[model samples]
Target: MKFFNRLLIDFAYYLQNSVAYQQKRRFFYNLLENDEYKYKKYFDICMIILIFSSVSILIYEVKKDVHDYLNIFNSYVISFIFLIEYLLRLWVASSVSKVIINQDEYSDLLGREFDLWFVTKKILKEKFEYILSPKAIIDLLAIMPFFHELRLLRIFILFRVFKLFRYAKSFQTFSSVLATKKFEFVTLGMFASIVIFVSSVLIYVMEANDPNSPIKTLYEAFYWSIVTISTVGYGDVVAVSKEGQFVAVVVILAGIAVLAFTTSLFVSAFTEKLDDIKESKTIQDISKNKRVYLICGYENIAKEVAKKLLLAKFHVVVIDDSLQRVEDAKKDGLTALNYNPGSIESYAKLNIDMSVQVKAILCLREDDVANVYTALTVRSINTDVFIMSLLMNSKNRNKLIYSGVNEILYDKEFVGLVAREYVGQPVAFEAIHTLRSETSAIHMEEIAITERILAKYPTVEKLENIKYRIVLLGVHKKSSSKFFFNPSDDTELETGDFLLVIGNYMFIREFNKHLSHKGEV
Candidate 1:
């Protein structure tokens, strides 16, 4: 018992510490539950196909006999797959080993004996909670048709259709909308029930004595009431008496009012959720890319930057709290989200930490406070992601830096400096401005010296020889974090160094392609 206990503890510790194990677990978790996972859509598609096929087979069997092979495949094969899905879901729902390890660590900290029974109970409690969850219950029921020996349990084969709710995000969204209006729905339900009950009672009382009336019993009257309220008058049941006809008219009017109310409620719920659904789709689309520029504000500067990034073939996602700004970004043909940049929940919703695709975060909110908060929130979620923010006020520069802003732009100060420079060198300033602006075909671009580039061109002279049209203005060294202006030909190029080059946009593109293909330009 002692040996077995020790082995179990060691196993739990291994599970908690093992990188490979944790990675595998995380992959499974993402595959099963993470909507932003790259392969989740494919997984969902496959599951949907299986569900439809299984349900189709079940429905087919209802009217006619199925082949023994088809029956076996549906009953055993699909059920087996569902059984595995259920177990995997259960496994990912909560970590039993994590709970065990936490308990063991707590026991050690308190200098007490490890309580196996306590850990067992806690694990059981978590598993039980998961098992009782609506999705999990559906999963369990979906697998019940495997036990075909029990003829009564065969009806559960239909529950496989409900499994679509798990894979279809739209269904979940609809369910969420309905969940939010629970109180209103409950009130509507109560009112509807009262109307139905009263209508049924009145119809039964008025029609029971009338020999010509089709509703002879309370059950029949209840059925008639449902049919009438639903506006599906089968014409099989008729109220011959005037009193019965009056009740029917009243019930029909109430049904129309109830339906109108229900329609209004659904319309309002969906209207409210429309933005959220769009945002979710935008996030999913952003997640599909392996690299994306995250712009926190959809202001003028941010919009221009996003456009430039998009033109450069880089994915860009604009996020702002202002709905108008988000809408403007959408209008401008950009992926945008209406989300609070300062809120940690927004970062989590974007899956920033989980996604290595976020190449950089640009906080360009006009408000200094909002920029600082956004910087802080992003830094907390992702430490290594490059962050740049616009410094509206000079005084907040230190605060922005402390909040983990890698670069800070001062619009006023920059403009002032440019104005001063323009006074001294009007022609030079204008030429530079023209080159930077959209009107000019010439553009400035940075080319990073990757391992391939470093191997091919070890010196500045070698790189310059590769392309004559492109001018190597300066080299930004990653090591010293400084730019070497007009470096000598003998200057050594290294990995992580960026070549600041100026050329026509087409020339730059050709130069990059030359570097990539390792061929003569």
Candidate 2:
């Protein structure tokens, strides 16, 4: 027995820490998200609807005098599907991937390879644990039609309603709140049960022998007690005797107190729950965004850049260490996360690595070390992601460059450059001012020759027509790492090439609108 137990423990270790286990976990979690896998989400939604409909049918069957064969057939069909789902879930536990990496168990089990006995043990462990899981139990009860003797199992069909909580965030929050306050609720329940019982007995004793009493039996007295305590006293039941009337008054007063206390508890819990739901909604919104401008620091420069980005109709996600700055950003109508800006863990929490939607990350920290460190971390996660850093001192610009920052803006030098431009040409300064404002009709925009643009306009000359009064400036090719300035008409456009064009704001909007609608607009 000891030898077998040791082997089982080793098997459980591999099963729990395998690559397939983590992959399956991610797959299921992503399926609940709207933007990740649409088909999987649809499958989950269909199953939830079917489960609820099945329960409703079972309820209908309970009340119907005439038995419907169609209902039985439908139940069988749903059960079969559920059975398949259950089996699939169980099968996924013994994942196909044999190797595990970067896990805590990897160090201890370094030299071991998967063999026949290990595989068998892992499979057994998976099946054993899954059969004991809460979802599996619910699934089993849902398909209890196969066993006619377990008619009571139909009561567990109500668990189907709770399965919706897995998909709906609001429902999940509500359920979590209830679970968190279960102890308090249970205490209140016990007190209320005692109140009802005591009141019922007193009313029964006081009014059982009265000539004008509507309450006679224990059940009738209990019903009267509950109705009176609930403050919904019907005139059909009343206490005729003075003693019974006094008891009724006391019960009414107790009901008022109970109602007030219960309402307060729910209100208090809901207030906290609202904040949680808000954060969850923000994460969901982030997940749905196709691209966002990620601002690392919440400094003045960061704020200005974020405002411009927002005005340009680009989604912006701000990460700040200071809670006050995060709140300020939130007040300004930007989605802000409060955490360590330099930590990759913070980015992970925001699902940065999981999303290809981070268009650019702007490091606006005054501290050079922080900026360099953060830029390196961002590049490590996304090699192709564009990174721009704001430099308080020109000397630290190389630090940012060495850390793989794509662009470095010397804030001090910018002040002198602005003065130079303003001294020579007022119109040039105004043009720049208008461009920075993000609302001017004439602005500079960079449109990449993505696959979509490649399909629409294959060459540089093909896109030089300027239908909306736009100017073709230059193309920044990713492969060459150089900008071709006004090349010949034959200069071809390729994927990853950024077309720098100074055009009317409306013209840029037209490109986005046409591309999005495939020229429908």
Candidate 3:
């Protein structure tokens, strides 16, 4: 029954390879199929089967006679399968357009001008270069015509299975980790190469002349060198003479030291890279359709500020000199633009748009001087733009305010305020901060009563007593900073009348109904 099922599947795949089926395939055909999970399931199953089969073959190779027979069978069978698979892949390459339209595929490969034979020839010729890459070459070599002579080359077939490891979760993540730490890895690789080469040469010199020695050529020395350094000590090869023994001690000690050092290098590299990846992930999340909130430094307060900005739907763009903090920001899905925020060029390069409806710049650089400088540069660009700067020292607060920062957040004042509130305060410290935060998404906007609408409506405050949730907090008479707190219901609302309402965002939105109705009136 399983055999029948496998045969049916193969037949379906063959039938699906037809040109008629190809033309009707849409771009994103794979996506449209709605069987992504099914495809992945089948792919996973194939991977498991392939891995087990390879492992079984490797185990069988330990027995000489069975190894020879199995190797011969695999050499021919795999090569033939690869040949057919290669041909089939070329045939169905056109179907990728059903996945997504590539113009080159339409005009160049499978154009109306090309016949079946021509298309096949063209694809093979075009992909011939890619087919010659190290991996592909090994794959093709595993399946070549001289099957029996290349029994050992069946081992190269294992490379194709190794390719499957790339698709695995662990290997994929490892690859990304390597990519992130490519430079460090490259340096470590160079160090390892030097150690390996030096060890191999020394081992060959020390062991080559010994009668009982297995290390004959430089190649044999390389194998021994790898075993020693990795502490694998396979025991298949060893040195025997007194001088060789002395050399062995030195080599083994060197190997141990080198092994520890290399391990440390990789550990450090991966640690740094992982942190970077985390920070980048955090920045990406923060930047998604959100307003920018530039954090000047990686202070503890900056962390709290970032949380607040995130709550208000703002993408926090941080500029900090500390690479570690930048990585931390990335981990939090915040844009840690790694630079000293003190420089004018840094702000300019970051594209500080004064005119755009941005929330505000929160300056909290580690250095008081840097924060003040950053604030000054920002204020110079756009005097109308809001700047919320934290002054580390109370002395800088007056300077920052005079320098044209809209709001100066004094840590001392904040701490004192919190203490005062703990004793007994009118409002919560957090609530006061929320209302004072110019960058908050929830803002109290004052809309003036225009005359055209007032001609029809005698009073705007009359609607306040309707028992709805929207409260009339205050009324500001025209051109006066003085606002009437909790204005009367019958107060005649004239032109240029400013009404202050207090509620959460939904009520504020609902509060706009009065303006819209007035416009219609």
Best TM-score goes to which candidate?
A: 2
lDDT of 2 by residue, 158-267 (tens): 66565665555567678777776778788888878888999999999999999789899999999998898788888788888999999999999999987887887788
Q: What is candidate 1's lDDT per residue for 99-216, written digit by digit as tens?
A: 9889888998999888888889999999999999998999999999899889877888889889999999889988998888888899889988999999999999999999888889
Give a tens-digit lDDT track for model 3, residues 142-240.
455335464565456556565554335456566667666667668767877887888788878888987788889899989887887778889998877
Candidate 1 scores a C-alpha RMSD against the true structure in Å of: 5.1
**Cα lDDT, model 2, residue 88:** 67
**Rank order (by lDDT, best first):** 1, 2, 3
Off by over 4 Å in 3: 1-291, 380-383, 421-458, 476-478, 490-498, 503-521
Q: Any runs in candidate 2 off by more than 4 Å, and if so which?
A: 1-40, 55-69, 83-141, 144-159, 367-385, 398-404, 424-437, 447-470, 474-479, 490-500, 503-521
Estimated TM-score for each candidate: 0.75, 0.76, 0.39
Query: All predictions: root-mean-square deviation over Cα?
Result: 5.1, 6.0, 15.0
Error (Å) of candidate 3 at residue 422 is: 5.0
Give the range of the ten consecutive residues with the poorest summed lDDT in model 1. Answer: 512-521
